[model samples]
Target: MSSINAQRLTVLAGPSGVGKGSVKALIQQHYPWVWLSVSATTRSPRPGETDGVDYHFVSHERFEEMIAAGEFLEWASFSGNLYGTPRGPVERQLEAGLPALLEIDLQGARQVRVSMPEAQLVFLAPPSWEELVRRLTGRGTEDAATIERRLSAAREELTAEPEFDHTIVNVSVEQAATELVELLGSPVKAAH
Candidate 1:
């Protein structure tokens, strides 16, 4: 495989319950210096999620205002809530020569492909369709209706895996993180 530019901005995308968050967290644990952009969302905070950290929770009107002002690099509505990556923070990270990571949906990933053609897109895929269904249902957070919707969306997202520069099957968080870190060509602190 070709070496990746360490400073190149990367967008990591996958369907819900495909372990994107787990892989990202593992990467951060191994490479603390790497910067991951926190997205802004109009959705309410989940159980232990924090504002300004996990996500920048915003009101629907505020989100729309930001959209009008061209504040987001990409924005999309999912599961009845709006989610977007703030343009300023990501630009700052890239401008500072940092390896920036954006964990977003397929819609946002497509937007990044248009806005930043050089941005590397990585797709995290489940080992199998059955595994995906198991993971989604095992989450225990969503209802049957939501799970069904997510499964439908997952099927669509799976079709877009070929659109990414790389596809990593998330069988193990450590292995996936190592592969992702290698793809970024960045130094790691230590695996957690």
Candidate 2:
């Protein structure tokens, strides 16, 4: 297989409650130059999430339209909602010599791997299942049923860690994000 240019795309994927959001925030706060792709979702935004920031909140119709137009780099459905990475923005960022990072789920990461073999896939694991449970429950975003559902999904995601190129245990969000930035800084290989 041919290696890509030094401008690599990095994917940060982990189970729920594994601090993906915290790591993403750290990347945004500390590494302003690294561009994180904004995903489009058919799900409704939470209380404070703004359109085009947390996600490009679109109707189911619009999302289907984008899918039909082949405008997504990768798309997947999770937790009863559709999510996809927009193609145009990611290409624009990469064309401008910026590193593109996509913080998404394992399924989405897998899809990206198939489509863009050059993208670096990183898996973020929790210290323990108990710790994961504690974090998920403490977040208070989900009810018992929802928490259980997410935990189930987490289990599946954890099982697939070895499929990734690198695995980082997310015991501390700052530490994990720092490591992520380090990986981001590394030069990409044309053929890996």
What lDDT would candidate 2 get against the real structure? 0.87
* Candidate 2 per-residue lDDT over residues 84-182, each given as its tens digit: 999899888778777889999888899999888889998999999999999999998779999999899899889999899888899898899977877
Could you give candidate 1's per-residue lDDT for residues 68-170 as a string of tens digits? 9999889999769999999999888778777898988899999999888889999999999999999999999989999999999999999999899999999
Which one is best on lDDT?
1
Q: How close is candidate 2 to the true structure, as a TM-score?
A: 0.89
**Which stretches of model 2 miss by more than 4 angstroms?**
1-6, 186-192
Q: Any runs in candidate 1 off by more than 4 Å, and if so which?
A: 187-192
Error of 1 at 170 (Å): 0.8
The number of clashing residue pairs in each candidate reads 0, 3
User: Which 10-residue window in model 2 sums to the lowest lDDT?
Assistant: 183-192
Best by TM-score: 1
Question: Candidate 1 versus the native: TM-score?
Answer: 0.91
Quote the positional error of residue 141 for candidate 2 in Å: 2.7
